[model samples]
Target: MTIADLHTLTGAYAVGALPEREAADFRGHLTRCAACAQEVREFRETAARLALAVAEVPPAALRVRVMAALPEVRQLPPVPAGARGRVVSLRDRRWRHRLPYLAAAACLVAAAVATGVAVEARRDADTQRDRGVVAEQRARVVSALAAAPDAAFHTGALTGGGSATVVSSTRLGAAAILYRDLPPLPGSRVYELWYSRDDVMVPAGLVDTKDPSGSLLLQGHPNGAVGVGVTVEPHGGSDTPSGSPLVVVPL
Candidate 1:
């Protein structure tokens, strides 16, 4: 695959979605590219985190109900030879007695399936609503910081490529970072912003990997912070930086 095409496989590789031949090629590329290697590590960690986040245990009641219904769901016996012309016998009566039990079991299964679908739909709706609210709040914060009278902007070069611009406002008590020409990270990795206070790095916010060049409104106030630092972190971000800053811009 071409170099540009290979770059796009970082996500697939991290999730083990790549074919054997393609994965081998990507491994070769990783040896020569420090940035790609770091991205791969971040992607793997992100995938693990996501797996844990969405995992759910089946309800105990559901299991119990399924087990209880198993005995009631029996297979009907085949008709005996020449039985079609005979009168209803004991075997026929027994089969007739099981009809209601069979119907009840089928209804129970249908009800369970309906309940599951309804629950899933409600959960998805709630999640979407929460995301919308968060996005709206973030947009307002970013806009306010941009328009603040005391806002000051500083630019710094990143380690591998591109540059970062940090905008801090004493009036708004907040900061924002704008990434320019930044390389895209794997789905499992994110660009994290930090506030440097007394040589200690505090996680400020996470930049979306999908939009590497987009802007992010940093969390917490920028007060007492000497500067802002940007680093690559796993999907969710780190409480403290895991490595040296890719770029640090004075506040």
Candidate 2:
């Protein structure tokens, strides 16, 4: 699974919402990604605290909804009949006296797992809310671009000898972008967008156009941008421009 998708499932895995096979897969990821482990620990603690405060029966409709959304849960693989245990080490023998503490730890883990289900439900709602907000923003950007007039088109040349155009509407405070002759970067590097005014450049966003040429929509125009700029940056981009922009289009 992609890293983002795996991150999304951390809450579900903490509460055992995943099938046995999928949970095992996430367990392997937990060993590698410390951030994911930290998230699970935090969410588990929240779940445990909320569980103690609530004793009400869950709505039947909620149960049906959750079950419908979940994938089929897998049963555990059977143990071989002839499998044998290894001889106990001296360390194991010494630890036998701590069985009571071990049992308590197991109970805590089970309780945390139970509370995690409730936490996952809340997370699902938040995720849906976030998605809705993003969808609405994208819709506004599209509408703004579609309504921009021909006189709004502005063009300029890149510092590295390429050309770009920005179709902008100051009234709407948005722009649509297209550029060509700009070479692509290797590996995870790509072009990032910026807006400049009064000689100060502000980041607009990033572009992931893999081909030699492409078009993009610029939403949420910077406060005082009189021009658009594009530069080479690391994959996700930076708060400030890393270097002089390779593409500069006057707006």
Predicted structure with the largest TM-score when compared to the true one: 1
Candidate 2 structure quality by residue, lDDT tens digits, 1-251: 77676776665665555779878888989999999899677545433432322222334665775675444323335645564466667887677668658767766665665456668777766766675565455544543443332225566887756677676765566676666667767889878888887888777777755555545666466447778888888888888888888867877
Q: What TM-score against the true fold does each predicted structure earn?
A: 0.46, 0.41
In candidate 2, position 116 carries an lDDT of: 68
lDDT of each: 0.73, 0.65
TM-score of 2: 0.41
| Candidate 2, position 223, lDDT | 43
User: RMSD for each model, in Å, please?
Assistant: 14.9, 23.0
Best by lDDT: 1
